[model samples]
Target: MKPTGNTILVTGGTSGIGRALAEAFHARGNQVIVAGRRQALLDELAAQRPGLVGWPLDLDDPASLRRLADAVRERFPALNVLVASAGISRPEDMAGDCWDGFDAEAIVTTNVLGVLRATAAFLPMLKRRPHATIMATSSSLAFVPRADFPAYCASKAFLHSWLQSLRHQLRKVPVEVLELAPPYVRTELTGRGQAGDPRAMPLDAHVAEVMALLGRQDHPRGEVLVERDHARRWAERAGRYDATFVAMNPD
Candidate 1:
């Protein structure tokens, strides 16, 4: 939350938003450890950036998450910031008879359960720090569901509620719970070529805005919503929830 100087662990740090934040934090003098499922990618990132630590982790596996937490506590005792950015998004056809090809279960496990387990594992260590931050990468779609990715949107909605409760419960503690609701950004989370999509916000530009918001010296709120996402952010408050939902998912 302080922007720099603290040891931070970022899940899904191999690509997309996670990777951008990791690089930015590393550049700002934070001891950044990037955790991802790909060892080669992590190694490459570490090699490319001096002092950037890479740790291989599988968020879907509870054992792997526990091991990662142990390793972090033993290796980086000063770790105080955690970015739970690991997630999966896949299209689901409700009209289809069979669910053989759909990834509903995997999406829920990775997005919801993954965040819960990771936070549980690292929370004790975080609480010990003088100042700590737990940031989860929810999506703007949480407020407005996308028909094709229903499960993904629902998972983020669950996170929105969970994070609010977590933040309130930890209000008296040194830990800070933050939710990052990103708009449709140029990222590979959807699939290949998405990072170059004209409809999506450029990854660098999104990260710049995110960093600027986080670095605010005045008052930093628990939720980080960008200007581009204002329409989705205010859908319910503006009495356009029904219209926005229909517009977001025409299919």
Candidate 2:
């Protein structure tokens, strides 16, 4: 949050927005720890960057997060920022004959419960710092559901509401809470093809905008929203919710 001189831990830092943010912070001379499930990727990233620490983390497993918490507490006692960027997305069609709750459960598990767990694990330490910050990634679709990805949109919607209460509760604690509601970005979150999708915003481009936002402290209501995300994010306020939902969900 300070742009530099703070220790930060970024979950899902092996790829996508998480990796970009970790690298951006590392470039700013912050002590960065990238937590991910891939040991090899973590090792490779750390090998390429001397000060970028990579620790194994499995968001679905509580024991794994516990281990990560212990490691961070012992090694980086000054950690003041947590970027809970780990998440998954899946398209589901409830009308399908094979429709079940499997994909929905996974989405809620990682996007909803996982974020809560990560926050619980690090919030105490964050509270100890005078200028601590908690940032979690949501989605622009949270404001208006995408019919194809019902569960994913719902998961992000949950975070959007949860973060408001979290920010209010922590307001007096003086720890800033930010919700990063990114628009459709070119990433492997949905699968390999999304990374090459021409319609998706470039990963680096989105991260660049986000970094600029962070540096400027331009977030309103602790929402670090990019320009592209504004339309969908404020669709309801703009009297365009129904139209926006139809546009995004048109099959």
Q: Highest TM-score: which candidate?
A: 2
Q: lDDT of each prediction vs. the true structure?
A: 0.91, 0.94
Which pairs, if any, clash in model 1?
none
Candidate 1 lDDT tens digits, 14-58 = 998999999999999999999999999999999999999999999
Q: Candidate 1 at 25: error in angstroms?
A: 0.6
- Model 2, 164-208: lDDT tens per residue? 999998778979999999998999999999999999999999999
| Span of 10 residues, lowest total lDDT, candidate 2 | 242-251
